[model samples]
Target chain A: MNDSAGKIKLPTTILMIVAGVFMILPFLWMISTSFQSPSEVFSKWLPSKLDWSSHERIWTGSYNFVPYYLNSVKISVISTIGAVFLSALAAYGFARIEFKGRDAMFLVYLSMMMIPPQVIFVPKFIMFNWMHIYNTHWALILPGMFSIFGVFMLRQFFMSVPKEITESAFLDGAGHFKIFFRLVLPLAKPALATFAIIDFSWHWNDYENALVFLTSPELYTIPLGLQNFILENNVDYNGMMAASSAAIIPMILIFLIGQKYIIQGISSSAVKG
Target chain B: MKRRSWIQKQGWIGYAFIMPNMLGILLFFIIPALFSFGLMFTDYQFANPNVSFTGLDNIERLFQDEQFYSAVRHTGIFLLSVPISLVIAFIVALVLNRSVYLKGLLRGMFFLPYISSGVAVAFVWMLLFQPSHGPINEVLRWIGIATPPGWFADSDTAMYAIDVVQIWFMLGYNMIIYLAALQEISAEQLEAARIDGASARTVTWKIVWPLVSPTTFLLLITGLIMTMKSFSLIQAITQGGPSGSTTILSLFVYKTAFSYYEMGYASAISWFLFAVILIITIIQWIGQKRWVHY
Candidate 1:
């Protein structure tokens, strides 16, 4: 039995190590190719020198990444903050407070999650044009702030907070606004953090929406900037790779910092689903 | 009586709290959704006020359109990656469920792709599959194959290349979900199966596999839905080209509306996409009873 167990370990380790390498090979390649010269990219496995030209070109050129990077951070951060606050407020109402037809209304809101965002691009285009927000960051940020999933997830979290806590707070003659800001929101910090992190990453990584809405080169987010880089310098693999590398730095930073909640959030979503 | 009055007062505040989101949803999502249904029947060019009610013309064009048919076919190929990723993720989950070295690190590495920017992911793979001297083809030639597929450069092979990226992209997410389900399985159940003189294969098939079928079911339905709607990676990599061979349904909708300014035609294509999603959802609602072991 011991001998058999030892034998199985070798193949499993080899298999896992190989899979692990495949998982990260693209990221490694992104960094490696970014630093390699055009001539040496396909020829060399790793760059011979730590090249800074590609990285330098992005900042100093006519098309700078400064606006793109700032746009991404600005859009995602604002969207995340608004999403957390508004979702928590509404989810608090649904989870705790009672009103006429509340359950029925909540059911309607929940069903909207089933509607894929692709189905709306046409009318949204018309609507945004009419509203005069087309081709602006507002087009992305406004709709982005309202995540149905965030409301649902935070509702679940809020529901698990004992009702007695809310009841006792109510007895102190405090209004719903005060109780929410003073009691529920503070208690649901972990849930809020989880949603904020997830939402931030999503808006940060959002491409199709940003692609459709933002046409001006200056208003573009990081993903849009990277796509612009690709289109402008189609075969400039070194420059494209450098831009792509720069694009994911914030995401990697977020992942490293909040991976615990990110993983937990994913797991809980599966279990809950 | 006083307490009852206070409860009634709180109800109005509930509405106040919920009003902003409710109105936003109604305006942004519900209105647009209903508006698209209306647009499906119109000859509305985007940003052009000259609109005509060409009832059913767009829908008629959709059925007769050759590009629509190919988008459907590409969507079928794209969805295939979901199941393929699920199987591989399940196997990996089972392996890592046991006492594996660097399990946490491996889990994080795999999940990174799922969370990474789609454009970045697409660009890296484009370089790797750079047909002539790109590393993937180079390695294929090195391994004794005289000719290799022209991945993104060839119309015939582009969809399959996208599948490889989709599979890689979804593997970590599927694995993480599977790992969660696997952790829920009790060890005593596996021990009991082994004690009954069952081989490792028997234990896995009869015990572990059955236990995670619900996760499998959940991932399948959601993954299929999510993968069909995925656009960015394909948009960045090929933009439905080397001749539009990789144009899945969502990309087709994007092109018809934004690229061609054919809002009416795009609405028709997207409505078809929604109908397909509805059918899959209905199937999951019904099919869960038959095979999704709780």
Candidate 2:
């Protein structure tokens, strides 16, 4: 970072700024278009005056996003909590306790990560339908609870912690559950936080599963609601943009709050993998 | 002996710890996976349950279908984003790794797309690339091009347009990873290269790039895998439209299963999709040894 990076050259700096602008242009357009009146949407780049009507319409009109936002919150929060806890529990067990065929089972579990979620949608549809949860949020939440990637990522983090810490706790006559709750869980907070944020985004942005499983508009997540908005008002660019903005603004806030964790988590996951 | 007893006893509790998650995996993942495999040989439509085993029939259709081939081709085009994104991200990361202004803000800007919901991304790109008067074409026209490409509206260019979105979506992740790898390179090494009178280009190509080959390899494999599996963006925008042009394999499977309720055929295509991913992964694993420095 020192001798070579004394100063950024002009061309490189210009190129970087250009790239950055290109990256953010769509987002800016989305936000700006949301403020344009419907008649002025395609005619101009920026609105003469920012309109709040489009934003207000999302809540006050027949086309409401309140239910979708609430459902997304419910599913992402519940599923993320359930996924983080379950993955950590499994990861801790695999990391700490020595059982026969444990490595073999973990190996099998690791291989399951390659099987794309798309492959099993048909059978999941069948199974969920049979269980009478097909049109329910449980269809998404139940499957979302078990993330093989979460377990795998946490297992890597857990494996790096000194075995002696958990081993000594065992010698103190504490059970695995007690140590897991009291010691291991507290120690793994950073890793757990990282995995929780990752899983939360997955459930939050998930369109395919919600599109397939949940039928009722009342059961729609943010993605489904956005789609329905698009279908009903393809011509209403301002309204559509408003809905899109509403959908992502929370995620943007979350990213701003947790960017440190998200960056660290991504790097660690890549390097360790 | 006490420790042995504890180890033995805790082994049972290990099952307890993993039990809930394992049960979940079985119920939700493993069983469905196996059921899909079985359904590949049978005519199992959702809710019309007169199931009959039709061995090899679905496979035959997969190999013969023109749309299947188009999906395979679109998937290839979609996958082009992985390397393109990696290259661009690597360049951005190299610059950002240096003395740059507002580095944190720029990094966040690039990464915003990856974290933003796919639906918003889809809609935003739609507006940006809207063929008639979208900003992109307006820029092209302003630059003296009489006819710019109809990005999402035209079938011929639709897949490439989606590739652009995918590349933008993945750029931040790749940049961060590459930045991490760049930081790992010792300052002394770069200083040594400069001491030998090497140009910055030579230093980056000969020393820095080779050193971060492992990160590139990691990004390539993971990006390829992830981009291959992702279809929600395509589903959100175009939806295999402009006459079924942007249909990647994942979206194809989604449409087949949910839209048409052809579960058996969908399962078959999905198995093929799995095989495609598996082969790509195995190829990457074997290929990594050739270039991955670490």
Candidate 3:
């Protein structure tokens, strides 16, 4: 029996290693292709000639990706901050304060999750066009600031906090805003971090909305910029791969930095629901 | 009396906090969704909004449209792939659920594809499936096959290629969700089954499978909705090409509105897709009572 169990372990170990390799292969290919010259990129094995010129061109040339990176960073940071702050406040309201239509309003917020974004794509485009925000960063940032998911997630976290703490703060003559900022915000750190990471990654990688709204090349986010890159330089596989690799760097950084919170956030939500 | 006023003030403040989002949804989401339903009945065009009202003309045309039928067929094919992918994800999740070294690293590696933009991954797959220089055909050549089908270029194979890419991208995410569900199952139940001399397969079928049905159901419903609406990957990879063989409903809506400038027709297509998904979701919700353990 022991021998049989040991035999099973050996195959499982081998299978895991194989699965790991399969999972990492694309990332490895992305990095490998990015460093290759035009001639060597499509080669059967790894690139023979390692050329880093594409990376330099992306950073320093006329159509530099620095602007795209900056646009992504600026939009993601502002929107994430905006979303966290506003959602936390709303969450506190929904979790703690009772008012008319409170349950009904919460249901409305939850129902938004089921409504496909495609349903609103055309009208929202028209709306944005009318407002003259179609081609600006405001188009991207403003809509994201009012995310329902963040509100709902944060509300769940806030509800779990002890009521005694809020009562104590109230007794100390702290107003709602003061308690929200000073007391509740600090306590909801894990939830806040979780939503921030999610929002950042989502906005950073968002392509469809960016594709539709940002018509101008100057306002192009990284995903849009990368798609434009592919359109213009479809034959230059090396350059395209390099651009793609660069675009994914920030997401990897986010995942690494907030790995714990992301896991906790997802698992907690899954179990609770 | 002072405390009552404070409570009222706090309630108002709460409303203030949620007001921005509520207003945005009312303006942007709720209003547009209702307007889209209205647009379905009209011949709306961005260039000619005044001559918009067509009175169910677009919906009538949708039934007769050959491309719409083709899109439906393609969507059906895509939906068929979802179950296969989910099963693969479930198997992988079960394998990974066991205690293993480098588990976090493995999980992250699997999840990398999910986080990256679908367009980027589609581009990589496009290169790897390129007719001449791609390694896929190279491997096929080594396996004693004289000639391999051109993956995305062949009309017969393009939808299948798109399905393969979609499955690869989604498998990791589904696996993670399943892993989470698997962990929630109590160890005592499994131990009891083990002591009763049940085989692993029997234990899984009778115990773990029933327990994880809710997660499975959730994955199924969400996966169906998502797959039905998938456009970006299809656009990036196939462009619904090789004689429009890979065009699903979402891409059809996009092409109809943007490429062909048939806003009313696209709106009709969108409504059709929405109704189909709504029916499926309702069925699943009703069926959940029977199958979903939770």
Candidate 4:
């Protein structure tokens, strides 16, 4: 029995290690390829000559990646702020307020989640054109501000807040706004943080909508810029890989920092839904 | 009476909170949906924004469009691949659920592909599927299978190749969801089965499997909808392929609007795809009531 148990452990351990390595391979390749020279990218093994120059080039204005990175950071920051603020307020209203058509209206918002964004891209483009917000930062920020998932998830969190706290605040002559800002908002920190991290990561990595909407080079998000870089040039595999690797750093850092909240947020929301 | 008036007054504030999102949905979602439907009836072209309406012409052209037919075939192939990937994910989740060591780390490892930028993931797979000197071909050679088919380059295998990448990218996400569901299963129930001398296979089939069926059903329906909308990886990896063999409907619509400059026809196709997804979702919803076990 002891021997069999020990044998079982050995294969499971090996299987886990194999799976771990497979999962990390692409990321490892991305980093390795980024550090390779133009000639060494396609080599079977790690690059023979590791070049640190690409990293320097990206940072020190030699490479044109600064603008792309700046654009991504700007857009992600603005969108995250917008989404968190508006969604939180809306969530509070949905959870706390007993208004007419509230359930029906909330259902309308929830149903929007099922409609694939691709279906709306063309008409959105037309609308943006008419509004003259087509290729601007407003294009990215405005639409993202009113996230349906955000409102839904936050409403779930808000509902779980004991009703007594808000009711007491109301009894103490606090207005609805005061009760929300002072009592409910402070209590919902973890949920807000979770939403912020998710929204940041999503906007940072967003490619498809950004690709269709942003036509100008200056306005291009990281993924869009990276794709354009690949398409316009001869396969600069090293440069492309370098840019891609650089792009994911912020995401990795954000994930590591807020991973606990994000995991909790996802699981709790998933179970509830 | 004053307090009641105050409550009525705050109703507008609720609207205020929801106003931005409402405006966005109105402008970006609702209006776009309407325009897309209307575009189906007009000759909306980027080249000539002033083009006149052509009722049913675009929809009529869709019937004879060979590319559309091929795209339908490719989408069917993609739908077939979803179940295979889901099964792999489900099995992986079950194994991980039983194991004691480094489960979180292992879960994160699998989920890496899902979180990574789709473009970057596609690029990595593109390199992996390179006709020569790719690790995949290298492995194939080691197995004494010389000259494996050029995966994304060969028209016949292009869609299948894209499906493989899609499966790899999606495996961790679905597995994580399944893992979460698996964790909810009662340990006491499992222990009871163990005491009764039920084998692990029987325990799993009889106890764990039934409990997880609802999750499995949900994953199936969600996976189908998501796979139908999958275009980015295909766009990046194959660009609808050597001979449009990998041209699923989403990509077909994209090419129609952007490449072929036929927005009206693309809108029609988009609506058609939407209708298909809606129908499938409804069917799955009804079917789940019968077989999902929850």
Candidate 5:
């Protein structure tokens, strides 16, 4: 119905802007309080002076926030790389290569998507603890490597590749690895990038996994670290805001950079049955 | 012999490609899910290390447990926000679908909160909903309201307050999906309807809505499943406090297992939760045929 993209509806635009402001006010309040002194958190809605002490303290606080940040980076990077690689391989196999029971196997893989992590976390926790990997980065990294969404998304992209191109590569004596790396991977860059951004942010924003798996402060991700920071500094609204703002920045930056892909990925999967 | 050779080669390569993921899922997810059922029937404790068979005992305990019922009730109450949020999101998406100025910028603004960490959003909302000094209360006071409800602190209002936060958090996601669905509606149909003297409202209600029913059904099922299993928001904001008004099933299973070390009982409760979700999903699946035009 909105085929007239060049024509701007003034009233609807005004309504959207107002709604946008309503959506953005809480975030603005967060950034505002983050720069205020602790004394001004309740008294003033906006900070008069931009004080950097809250950021300074969180950076050098007793929590040793550096390691947590590093841990998150390491965990998210490794998990994204590993998950994307494995998912691509699996997707290539499922999409391009034929095997016995391939459809059945893919159906099994797809069904795993319906099982929420809560249904299995209890036993996984016990298993990890038994394996003596509890509270370690592997607990997060290893499990994050198994992503149903990654495989599913990549498969959709892979299936779109023309069969003739892959057959031509096979005719040139290229093996599965060579074709997957050289032919399919390069062609599926958009889908790969989409899944990468989604996976990275998901791992970055993960709190429940980190909460359940990591008990040590040094092993915490930003979300878990911010949780602890909130517990101890509940009254320290300035520091809490600063920490929350910091925790949110990386994801926000990623979203801004890949806004088109993120929204596309969301809509592509969400609109489909 | 040639065909057999090709089939064998392809099979080996296919299995090789999927080996890592298959192994990982097997170890982490598949096995754990199998163990979940086993864990439900056994008295497994972390510290004690005394595993004994107790068939159906955990399920019996769940039936008798009052807090389990409370968690279920709270989950049901929280899930009511899905319909509430659907209406809000639908209306917002309709507005957004119009030819509006600053479309990209406004859409990004609405979506910013969705990408932010749940903990951060919950913490920000906690500050906003603070009883006395919060800006929301300040606005209420400015309007000659003597006192506003203590949002998370009062048991009566705690669940609804959390529902408000959830609805706000999910509104952007739902709206984006609805917007996409709306945009997918073919212009030819609308043009024909307009030529037939049908009004815009009639076109929207009769043609636009039915065309988007599939997406609506998808959103409804996913939204219900998500809100039912939500934990981090409750954990960060209220921690299921104020007399257990916000203790949904996820929070209940978490606290029972970790806080109280009742692994067996927690496993059972989680299964119960799974059953609830499974049943609801099946019901929705069957019901969609009536309303889903596709």
Candidate 6:
């Protein structure tokens, strides 16, 4: 932790700040442009006056973003909860229970991470269409509720839970379900929270899946709805930026609140894999 | 009898625990993947309900598809982003690890783009790269450059333009990974190197780089796979436009399957994609043995 290497600290600090500016400038520009009037949007770097028309239009005008926001919240929340709960169950099984074919089952689950979803996108579309859920929120939410990555991550955390803890519970005649719910799940909250944040953000930003699956505008998530809004209002940068800022605010807030978990989740996955 | 019953009870517990997820994956993922493989050999258009089996016809057509090759080329070009992002991320992580002031603030700023939606990222960059009125060109003009390449609009630079955005998007994720690994390097070793009067460059190269190779390998593989399958940026930003210069394989697959409704052809294309991803993943597994130092 003693990182006071003074010789090159100033240069490194300055360099990182410059690079940080490169990273954050676009986001700052996004928020700035959203507040600019149409005439003032491209004329200057900063808005002359904070025009609320773009935000107002997106909320009240014909291009209402309320449905998109609500739908994104619905899908992300439902899928995040479902994925975490189900994956926790499976992780407990894989980590604690002496089940037949458990290792093989886990290997298959891990392999799911490598197979890019593009390969299955068409067929999943067909399947969802056949199931009469193609245009519904079910199309967006159902397929995402089972994340192999979540299972893989949580299983690692679960396995790290001391054997004696589980063994002692087992000796007390606590069944797998009882142990999972009463002990392991509580202990794995950090890992669960990490995966939850990840899953939520992934589902929130999922435009491609929504684009492929959902056809009804009413059921569209924010990403797909935003895309439609952009195409309809491509020349209206002010309005587009406003709508985009609205769509991105929730995820940004989530990241701000739980970014440590996000970074921890990612690095742990990397190191373990 | 007791042992057998206990074994049976344990099996039931395990099944109960795993059933919800397994059922979902089986119905949603495994079934669709298998059905897609079956569709690859058939001529299954969305309009025509009667699907006719056409063995190898789709594969034959895929070989002759010019857009497919164009997409493959664009994907290969985009793959350059993995190494580019890895190096940039590692350097940033290294520097950020050294300086402690406002570390969290700087890291959060760098990571904002990655957490933002693709639509937001694509739109913001598109506005920034707007040739006439955008700020990038304004800066370029002030610096005495009369014309900047019409980013995302000009065919010659469209792919590179997309690559730059992809790199920027990936840098934060990769940098976080590298930073975690770099910080884990023992303080004692760094102190030892300093006491021995080793230069910063040597310390980085000899100690820091080797220690972080495993993370670098992990980031490189994940980055490559993510970039290979990435299409949202193209969809939102360029729509693989400017004469298909930015058309990656995922976009092509999406277009073929949905836009054209050529499910069979799309399935074949996807199979090809699956094969490529499998090969790359295999290479990662094998190559990690050589370069990844645990």
* Backbone atom clashes (below 3 Å) for every candidate: 0, 0, 0, 0, 0, 0
- Return the top candidate by DockQ: 2
CA-lDDT, candidates in order: 0.88, 0.88, 0.81, 0.79, 0.85, 0.86
RMSD of 2: 1.8
* Candidate 5 Cα errors over 4 Å, as ranges: A1-8, B1-9, B284-290
- Identify the superior model by DockQ, candidate 3 or candidate 4: 3
TM-scores of chain B, in order:
0.95, 0.95, 0.94, 0.92, 0.93, 0.94
lDDT of 6 by residue, B73-105 (tens): 999988998899899998888878876478888
- Docking tier of model 6: it is medium
Q: For model 1, how does the per-residue alpha-carbon lDDT over A63-106 read when each residue is reduced to its tens digit?
A: 68999999999999999998999899999999888899889989
Query: A1-273, model 4: which lDDT tens digit per residue?
Result: 224345576588678769778877878887887788877766745877789766765567444778888888988898899889888888888988767787888878866666666677777777788899988878888887778889989999999999878766776778778988888989999999999987887888787778778899988888877787677653767676777788776777776677678767876776556
- Candidate 1 TM-score versus the reference: 0.96
Name the weakest run of 10 consecutive residues (lDDT summed) in model 4 chain A.
Answer: A1-10
Write one digit per residue (lDDT tens) for candidate 3, span B55-124: 9788789999898899999989888778888898888777778745567877877776777755677788
Give the range where candidate 1 chain A is weakest over 10 consecutive residues by summed lDDT. Answer: A1-10
Question: DockQ (Cα-based) per candidate?
Answer: 0.67, 0.70, 0.50, 0.47, 0.66, 0.70
Please provide, for model 2 over B108-225, each residue's C-alpha lDDT reduced to its tens digit, 9 standing for 90 to 100. Answer: 8888888885887799899889888888988889999999999989999999999988888999989989988898889998989888999989998889998998888878888888
Per residue, candidate 4 scores C-alpha lDDT tens digits across B44-126 of 88767587789999888988998889899999998876788778888888878775367777777777676665676677777
Which fraction of the native contacts appears in each prediction? 0.68, 0.73, 0.35, 0.33, 0.71, 0.71
TM-score of 5: 0.95
Say which prediction, candidate 4 or candidate 6, comes out ahead on TM-score.
Answer: 6
Interface RMSD of each: 1.8, 1.7, 2.2, 2.4, 2.0, 1.6
Task: Specify the CAPRI tier of model 4.
Answer: acceptable
Task: Provide the lowest-lDDT 10-residue window in model 2 chain A.
Answer: A1-10
Output the lDDT of residue B147, model 1. 93
Better of 2 and 5 by lDDT: 2
